[model samples]
Target: MPKRYIVEVDGVPPSPSPISNAVVVGNQCWISGQLSVGDDGAYVPGSAREEASRAFAHVFRIAEAAGFSRSDIVYVDLAFIDLADVKEVNGLFGELFPEGRRPARTVYQAAKLPFGGRIKVQAVAPR
Candidate 1:
């Protein structure tokens, strides 16, 4: 079996729940869902676009901790409380991944999210 390792970024705040921010096994890194919480553990208040941006920033932070970049991401899973927020989220996604390098993504309308966040994002990346 491949060894598994837990990964955490320095500047990111710990989750209130018991969860590793990310985990690495073999050549793959699995990042946990990230909300729009700040390093101070406060949920940032803003529009869907702002919240989504913050969540993605946390995802990138975890990816970096696992020795990967956003471009190295192979898949992304997003949960949004409002389906209409997808347009805003997609803009950020495009900015992060660009045209030809976008990762496979799945977006869903979640019934609710932790911390009253509008969006949550999780990613898988090559380590």
Candidate 2:
């Protein structure tokens, strides 16, 4: 049987709920939605782009912990409290992935987010 591994970001607190930050099954990893909760265990205070950056950082951290490289990530999903932040987040996204190396992306607007966060992000990587 293929082993299952739980992946967590170093320096980040475990979730208050039962959910794993991410899980690896064989060559694939499924990452849970992440908010910009910093090492201090508080939602980061900043612009939408800044918060989104930290959230995406969590996603990548979990991916790496699961033995997947940045380029190995195949898909990402993003949720924003306001659609106005999409352009800013897109700029950061372009910088992170760049051209042909970009992962498949889906974006949505949320009526509300936990911790009153501005953004939430998740990723998937399969090898």
- lDDT by residue for model 2 over 1-127, one digit each (tens)? 8878888777665677789889898888999998999887688768988998898888888888788888988899999989999999999999999899999989999999888999999888998
Q: lDDT (0-100) at residue 100 of candidate 1?
A: 90
Error of 1 at 1 (Å): 0.9
Give me candidate 1's TM-score against the actual structure: 0.96
The collision pairs in model 2 are none
lDDT of each: 0.90, 0.87
lDDT of model 1, residue 84: 92
lDDT of 1 by residue, 38-103 (tens): 889889979988988888899998899889998999999999999998997788788888989999
Q: What is the lDDT of residue 121 in candidate 2?
A: 93
TM-score of each: 0.96, 0.93
Q: Provide the global lDDT of candidate 1 against the true structure.
A: 0.90
